[model samples]
Target: MALQVILFMTHRGRTQQLVLRLLQARRLFPEDRTGSRTRHQRIAERLGLGYQVSVMVPALLWVLTPALVDAMSAPAANGTAATRGTPLPVWAPFDLQRSPNYELVYAVQAVTNVVMNLTGLFLDVFFVTLMLHLTAELDVLNLNVASLRPSPVAPADSLESRDGDSLAKQASTDAPYTARGDSFRVRTSTSRFHMYRLLVKNIQHHQMIIM
Candidate 1:
């Protein structure tokens, strides 16, 4: 069990390090691209691999845990022979004569099986949730990137004369007034949809002014 714990911790630590490295690489070179793929794609592939390992390790352990417990409790060859010698620390726990509580041993194994199953279940749920969350975040990031890209038609050219006139009039009356300066600031606290609409309206007004 101690060895298993050590191996699990080692795997977890390495997985975390790999994921962090991938994230850092993505951040450092977001626009970097291969022949047919972008940095995001590369990072995603690495993340997916890490996720698979995270899921598979626990599942493998879950499958083998019962067998391992049974093997540990199984009687050795030349059964029912008592050994009267110095007690070695490693073999003391397995000495059935010295510890003849078969019921307790069985109870411990049952509890271990229950704990292993619960741990597996928890890990499955956690990984599923994490994958869903990462997918949603990636989708949102893609949408925001698409929205920010420049369209083929310039904003000034897209507006009709009548729309421009109306926008100018609206801007003169309704837009926040500010003096000419090197920089300006605008502040608002609003819901996302409302903020998006407000931004579109402001962009149209600015296009009208520029034209």
Candidate 2:
């Protein structure tokens, strides 16, 4: 646990950089028309919730086990009761045998345990969500690449016939390829340029994911 905390603190910059790269890739890539982005998002949420439930349920049970056992146990036959112990054993300066002190301390310990569990849950969920997002980005990149059409000849009056205007438009749009029939159809050389540019972006995104 100490090592985990130390690693997290020491590698905070790396985590931030990874998140930034993922976000940048997502923002710069084209999304699928089949509503995959939404589907992947929902899957990520469900997985995160599943992780929270799976981890916290057991943790809560473990934290409360001592209290539950104490409540369930029978008293001694000699008119004496079993001494109740704290959920977590910790040395204290003041006596914990008294009324408010024991209850307060027990409550504090239980709450602290839950909070620490939640902290671990947050870290787990963070990595899980990032991985889900990266997968979604890869899906989009694959879709774009698969949808690339053959380089067809452009008409004389098409956008490719124009000088810099077509290049400017291609540079501005993130998707670049518009949907047509089975694949992304190109009317001009400008659209071909867009396809190649998008493919390069996809390659770079894959490299980042690998790194």
Candidate 3:
């Protein structure tokens, strides 16, 4: 526990920076490419639920087992005081082995144990959420790349006559296109400009993830 605390303290600044970068990247790629509450959100929710169940089930068993055993093995009314164990072993200022005291201490320990487990689970969830969002962004980038198509060939003789047709086709096919729409056109000075822009954007995204 001490080591975990120390590690958290040491890496707190770095974690903050990572979170900041993630936020900035979100702004850069804000479009929900897969529509509302995409696959990543669903995955995160399932993972979080699984984590909660995984943490809580063991904790419940740990807390209840000792109490169940003690109840079944309780000393007879005529017998002397029986030894009892707390859910967790810990020293208390007062005698926690006595009635009400033991129950109260046990309840406190159970609550504390659950809270501690949940705290750790929350940390796990935070990192997992970040990873999921990163993956979602990468997936979006892939879709963008996949949507790109090589410019269709225009016959040299027909190129002059089909100039308007080519432009109209480009507009229809690449609706919502950005300024960097130049494709592999032999006559265009901005040939492959869209691909270059895409490459640069991906590189910047990669750098953001790295940082």
Best candidate per TM-score, number? 2
- Whole-model Cα lDDT of every candidate shown, in order: 0.44, 0.74, 0.71
Candidate 3 lDDT tens digits, 91-206:
98988778799889889998988888877888888789878877877777666666665555443334321234344334324232333455534333123545666677777877
TM-score of every model?
0.31, 0.73, 0.67
Judged by whole-model lDDT over C-alpha atoms, candidate 3 comes out at 0.71
Give the range where candidate 3 is weakest over 10 consecutive residues by summed lDDT: 154-163
Displacement of the residue 26 alpha carbon in candidate 2, Å: 2.4
Clashing residue pairs in candidate 1 (N, C-alpha, C atoms within 3 angstroms)? none
The clash number for model 2 is 0
- Give stretches of model 3 more than 4 Å off: 30-32, 35-37, 68-82, 90-94, 151-191
The full ranking of all candidates by TM-score, starting with the best, is: 2, 3, 1
Clashing pairs in 2: none
Q: Which stretches of candidate 1 lie over 4 Å from their true place?
A: 1-100, 143-178, 185-211
**Better by lDDT, candidate 2 or 1:** 2
Candidate 1 TM-score, C-alpha based: 0.31
Q: Model 2 over residues 1-211: C-alpha lDDT tens digits?
A: 5566678889999989988887777676647676667778899899999999998999899778878888999998997877778878887898777778888998999998888888888888887887788788778767877888756544434453222234334444434434333355434455566677777877887887777
Q: How close is each model in CA RMSD to the real structure? A: 13.4, 8.6, 7.4
Our model 1 lands, by Cα RMSD against the true structure, at: 13.4
